[model samples]
Target: MTESSKSAEAVWAAEPSTLLRVGPHFRLSDVDPAATPGFDGDEADGKRELRRTNSELADLQERLWAESRFGGERSVLLLLQAMDTAGKGGILRHVVGGVDPQGISIHAFKAPTEAEKAHDFLWRVRRELPAAGMIGVFDRSHYEDVLIHRVRGFSPPDVIERRYGMINDFESQVEQAGTSIIKVMLHISHDEQKRRLSQRLERPEKNWKYNPGDVDERMFWPDYMDAYQAAFERTSTDVASWHVVPADHKWYARVAVQRLLLQTLREIDPHWPAANYDVEFEKKRLAAS
Candidate 1:
């Protein structure tokens, strides 16, 4: 086994979800974005392991799709939230994108449209949910309403306060309806973010990714951290726990997310649906033809 696979097995076979889970009294400040918790591999190993695991992830995904075709209601929703240059786009492309696209649904939430804003915060979110048997990915999700809204003072204090409970309740409802949610926060350090932003500006191919607004948001880093801590405290629950992955090293982040996803799908353990037709009869019919 590769070191990356060993890293995954160590986490999976031992405590499973405990390593990355957000526990009560969890402090966001203590986490080092450059640290790869529970992983024993370097960058090269991580990339190799990701490639090795892609086939398995795809297999499990197909099984889930088959189960849904046979009337199963289980599905997965991967919710990714992060600061700019934190690699949400890379996760979508490298990790989740390894699976079959036919069985996956991806939606990236931006600022709400007038129509979306007319209703409750979750109205647009609810409409974008994946159906039974599909894997859903939200690049930036409902949490944005709380994160940006809280930091920018777009909403009143009381309004922001209430969203925590609303989000928890909404997630619980989604969980109860057979959708397993993997809520991830890709924790990137302030310096690393700056370096990445600078890289985008320096590289001709990546110049399009440079957003002036991101630099403005950096000024409110401390406030965003506070808002995230508040969100984790209020919303991370037994039904739908949050996993914070250190994302300074892009390879490690991708492997870690892929491992978490593999763990979830393994726990779900969906199998291929049994064939409905009689095998002997079909064989005899084919011979006659």
Candidate 2:
């Protein structure tokens, strides 16, 4: 096994509260991350869950398309966080990808650039904020203020403390502007992560995604866990809540993501756009020529 995988395996076997990858004062062991309680998605189960998840995702995408066409008033912003191999991409591909591309966008934010560091941490985030009548997704998000920043000592302790308050207010402002936030943390066993990471490294198509630095991050599981716990404690609220998604099996993660998205879209009640007869008439006329 690769060194990264081995590190994840150790964390997987450790007690849940020992790891901190997402929110404040939150521990993986405290709650059930399963979409279906008592679920087990070993190899055979993975296949079954994936099929169900795919159908659900397709259906929701259809709904989003219909809503967008109908001139809907609401917008949504979905946030996903996890350790490496947490299935963020898989969830996006299966659940939201088929939705009207014009109405949805995916932004996967990484470490700050030199320009990003010059301004307040929230500046880069504000630039990515979505407009009205659209769905925006963050593969990882500003909660990084509390998770990664705290772990790596990027910010002073007091500054980090202030950020939690700022984030809560920022989310509230977004809601007032007709955007809702839905956050998900993909929870995976360290063993499963090792397995998946190995698969990615071995596959020629996925080799480009494998990074050596990822292993270094893996070594500080305890520090990572502490950061996540603190972040979750401060940011989780009714307006912008966080959901822990068990991701040992990617299929299950996709399904949970689908369900969360469908629910959010249902809440938004996006209206489909009305048709204009002259537009179609002009199209047919051009085709005849």
Candidate 3:
């Protein structure tokens, strides 16, 4: 590895302790979108670190898969929640994309269909939970019921308030059942969001990504921030803690998330299972064949 590569690895390797960690006292407004916590390196370092982290994550994911095939029940779930244009898609593309598809599952939750709306808010979400030995990515998750519903008044105050506890209970149950949860909130400045939205309009290829309604939603930026604060207060729990990732610098956000995944997987420490059959016998059988 080059000097830069080594430095980057060191930075990422220490992230679990050095990075900003969300807890009950966490406040969204206190985070600086421009700040690159736990990583003092520049964009070049971040890019290089991302490559290394991706390879490590891919290897870990494969190990987790192998362990499951041999009867391990543990898995990982990465729940990503962010405002529009806050780099969730970028993280999915640049970070999670490096892992094996069979070992990872991605679910992008949008406005619920009528049939989905008929059931409890979490019904659709529960159905999509990742199985043993896989990494599940929720592009937008059950938090939307609280976020959008709270912001737009689609649900009454009591209902919105109740869903928070429900979400916490749901996550706790899933965690106890062997799925490790890593919840992340991508933090970006209002100005940064506007710039990204403008870019979407300016570039022909990005036109499809832009929604005029996003401008309407921007009108409620403060409301959304308040909603997010409420969410962190109510739903960020020990079983499924939230990590607020500063996302003004896309490169930094991507690398930070990669580091977070590495940390989570390292903690899980999925090992290769011993062969159930006799290794020597299998080797002899193969030789004979």
Candidate 4:
């Protein structure tokens, strides 16, 4: 295993909480996109471990679902933020797709509609929050309000500045209400992004995935990085800290995310809810029938 992968394995096996955690001191430039921080394995090993992690995640999700049916209060929300072509869809398909669909709620936020724009930025976000005992995944979340808005100058400087505190407060409120948040920023290098974008152009089947706007956005990559760095500094709070996953290696990214989810679920430690009825009476009644 590579030294980076060995380090990754240690992080996941021991203190997974600190794995890729972003803080006020976080520098986006300091992270190495090619480095695999937690798993001690090759691609094949990653795939195998991912399958195992998926099994555990699926079981935990089912238990959480059952607990919710019995009026449990806790749930989990995974908010994914990344630059284009950073493997958000892959994470969805490989990691989250393994879980029971009934226990998972996924929302892919796009440009707001006319009606949606009438309200505050978080109005739509508030509507999409997962209910008790479920796992929610946000493809692109309220962070977009800060990221895109900041990079493209869509929102005023003062308003964008205010949103940092607003987001922190909002997340704190959600945590207080029993929702554990796992926020991830999939970090990829500029060269890797170019390679992925080129593949989109070369493969006929992937042509649809290419957006002209993606190229236009690339011009502002530096600005966007600055915006993300500012966001991490302001919004990486105790309630919902950000995890910056190195995403150049798709396999490593998938495994790291799976491990992060497993760690969160482990902390939640949901159990199957106890039956509320008398087992002997129900068995006897059923036998009579």
Provide the RMSD of all predictions against the true structure, rounded to 1 decimal.
Answer: 2.5, 9.4, 2.1, 3.6
Model 3, residue pairs in steric clash = none
Q: Local distance difference test, per candidate? A: 0.91, 0.70, 0.90, 0.91
Worst 10 residues of 1 by lDDT: 8-17
lDDT tens digits, residues 1-289, model 4? 8996565355354443596999667899999999987566678888877886677789998888888999899999999999999999999999999999888899999999999999999999999999998899999999999999999999999999999999999999999998999999999999999999999999999999999999999989999999999999999988899999999999989988888898898899999988999999999999999
TM-score of each: 0.94, 0.76, 0.95, 0.95
Clashes of each: 0, 21, 0, 3
Off by over 4 Å in 3: 1-8, 12-18
Give the alpha carbon lDDT tens digit for every residue of 1-289 in model 2. Answer: 8996464233123222122224455665674443343333354554454454455445554555665456544678888889987788887776677566776778889988999989988888888877666678998988888887888888889989999999999999888877778878887766677787888799999898888877777777778867766777788777787777777666656655655666576566554455646888889999999
Q: State in Å the error of residue 199, model 3.
A: 0.7
Q: Which candidate would rank higher by lDDT, 1 or 2?
A: 1
lDDT of 3: 0.90
- What is the C-alpha lDDT profile of model 1 across 1-289, one tens digit per residue? 8997576455333332677899988999999999888766678878987888899999999999999998999999999999999999999999988999999999999999999999999999999998998999998999998899999999999999988889999999999999999999999999999999999999999999998999999999999999999889988899999989899999989998998888899999999999778999999999999
